[model samples]
Target: DQVMIISESDVKSLLTLQDAIHLTEKAYSELNAAQSMIFPAVREEIKEYQGIFGIKSSYLIAKKYIGLKAGGFWLGNAAKGKMNHQSTMMLFDAESGEPLCALSANYLTAVRTGAAGAVAAKSLARKDSKIIGIIGAGTQARTQLEGLLATFPVEQVLIYGKTEGKEELLAKEIIEKGYSAAICPSPQELAGQSDIIVTTTPSYAPVLHTSWVKDGAHINAIGSDTRGKRELVIDRKPDKMVCDLWVQSSIMGEFQHGITREELYAEIGEIVNNNKKGRENEGEITLFDSTGLSVQDLEVASFVYEAFKSKFV
Candidate 1:
């Protein structure tokens, strides 16, 4: 077995935003078709090592681009029960059962998550959106910025974070990437200036208020992947709402409190495939409630696996 361990740099060299978006859409479509099994039994808590360990795992096995991809993760206390950590894994193979590859999922997850948000922004955000407001200055925030810049012509970006040093550091890095980025004094200031706002924090309470959002703005809430991790107010509703998966979003995504499964206007995949219109009106406030789907991981992994195979063999 020739195990090819591709680094993040190697993956970046081989795949572009267009490639990632296409693969993500294809993965979501396949997942939507097989909705029955895609909705797995989510276990929030599990027993491990004769002790209680909190585990949030969702099983998703899908067929995409002539290969099978399985998505799962385990989150619990690590480091002698002093720290909290999560690990995600992906398994990929062709239909013939030939094991293709496995990857360290942190970067893969970040890229796919960012790509999915980009897809949502492409469909739901206004065409004239030039200013971006970002909350959280971490690894996920960087990818979100990269993905958004790849799809939209953002002119300025305002970032807010709890850590002042980290915020300034990220702002400098983002500015170095050729965008006008700065650390904002408050989330309100960030929200007021940006036409497109993306919140990538793990805040339990709302970090963004509805009153601060302007008309026709699009918001991508990327941090609220697990239950109780939301960044927007539950009482605040947007004019249009899109999600990666309705079933998953309602249960674990940011939409868990504000909207039900049936209330979602459209899935991002549907919008990407042109089955539904995104940003129909100019004054519409659109929200892309991202729960982070497994299909995205599967698609991106499959793409990388195929690229590695084609070049190596």
Candidate 2:
């Protein structure tokens, strides 16, 4: 009858970005192996506040974990001195359907999302890739950078955002963290210079175009998840178009805009399972169309729950 309640601080201390990456990667592999179940995402806009509310739920069979993350993004939260995106995760036992733990998931959401991009890059981006271009200056932008750095030997970071000074601020923070960084004057400049491009904005219109991108470059389109959101103008489809989950991305993800199901190369899980090929050559363009995944949240949540139990139970 009693459930463990874990705070944001506790989750922060328990899970690292690397840990989330590992768990998220494992989830993908398992999903491909038919060891997991991801229910459809439930997302809707709150017109009154220019906010979004959604629920992501999943079940990991072998891990015996069942959970869901509830909450969403509010554009006005910044004025209220709060994070734009907020969420809570609750885990239950898969066997008995008993509530096991509840944890503040703001941090988990960021890390897990970052992990998804990193995992995608590891499998698709060229090994020698060094420069990263990020289009967005928000929290997701920072986390996405963190993930790329952890996954690649990035020599430089390039940032581009519409908001004045935001890109500069993010660049300064990156430099302060001992990484080389610069603020690009435009998305085209950033894309032209980076070996890997990551889009993390909430733009409904395209921020990057095909002509701006170079061959052998990999792109992580993680910004657009809602129905009307978009980051890239898909004038030409990449050589390989991968998705974290086809069912979700094919409906509301970035690639959902002008790209069709036939254009999608494979789901990331299939590649992780070795059922499909990833990045066949250095001269090919690759794109990871991520819409986020409920299984990602479940895998990370289960890890946090276990870590908490071992320490305090």
Candidate 3:
């Protein structure tokens, strides 16, 4: 087997945020159609490997994953198991099971998650939104900011984190990149000031409350990936509730804890594909409950893999 090795740098140079976004939108459409048929049939098989260390918890996750794009079948026993994660995205050929190329999952994951957030912002956020609030000062946070700036002409950004040092560092970096940046004293203050709020922390308790949010604001709840992790209190339902994956959100993340399944307005894919409406009126609160998805990982990985092949080989 000619296992083509792809380094992080190769992946970085291969795929751009713009390319990831376009591919992800296509991936979401495929997922929406396949979810009812594909997800259900394969869910049990997928879940059988749940908590298998690298497969579910640590190895793979994206807000809007496209299974065939970045993920692949893992065939092995627990005693001597080998995980096969594929961006074997063979859209380039039909006869050859031969992978066109390999992609680094780490970089792809970041791009897809960021692109998903941007998609939500485009659909759910107010047209004139200029200020953005971000919680957490990690890799995901940076990508969220990048994706937002790419999609929207954000003028100012407020960053907050559990640690002052990291928050200040991130603020400085953002400022140097030419965005007006500041570190907020609290999440409440950030919520009050920002037109679009994105929370990226892995916190169980609510970091933001309904009362803190202003009218006509868009909230992207990005951190709640697991069952006990949530950042927002469901005190009041938003005017529209969008999620990247309905089943995952309903069972595991932000929507898992507080909001009912019926309250969810639409999936981000539906909004992006124009199958449903988003941000109907002014003074409406819109929320994007992101649980992360497998297809996003697949889609981004596929994009990177293809790009790597085109440029390097």
TM-score top scorer: 2
TM-score, one value per model: 0.83, 0.97, 0.81
Tens digits of per-residue lDDT, candidate 1, 67-137, equal 22233333333325422323344443434555455555556767777788887888789988899999988
Model 1 Cα shift for residue 26 (angstroms) = 2.2
TM-score of 3: 0.81
Badly placed stretches (over 4 Å) of model 2 are none
lDDT ranking of the models? 2, 3, 1
Cα lDDT of candidate 3 equals 0.72
lDDT of 2 by residue, 89-109 (tens): 899989999999899999999
Tell me which of candidates 2 and 3 scores higher on TM-score.
2
Model 1: pairs clashing at backbone N, Cα or C within 3 Å = none
Worst 10 residues of 1 by lDDT: 50-59
Which ten residues in a row are the worst by lDDT in model 2? 250-259
Query: Which of the predicted structures, 1 or 3, would earn the higher TM-score when compared with the native?
Result: 1
Higher-TM-score candidate of 1 and 2: 2
Candidate lDDT (C-alpha), each: 0.71, 0.89, 0.72
- Residue-level lDDT of model 3, residues 1-313, one tens digit each, is 5656667688788788998788767667766656422232112235675321223211112322223333432334323544232232222222334444444565666678888888888889998899999988866788899999988888999988985577888888888989899888899999999999999876768899867889999999998766666798967778898898877887766888767768889888787778899888889999998766656656666566556677777
Order of models, best TM-score first: 2, 1, 3
* lDDT, model 3, position 81: 43
The true-versus-predicted C-alpha distance at residue 199 of model 3, in Å, is 0.4
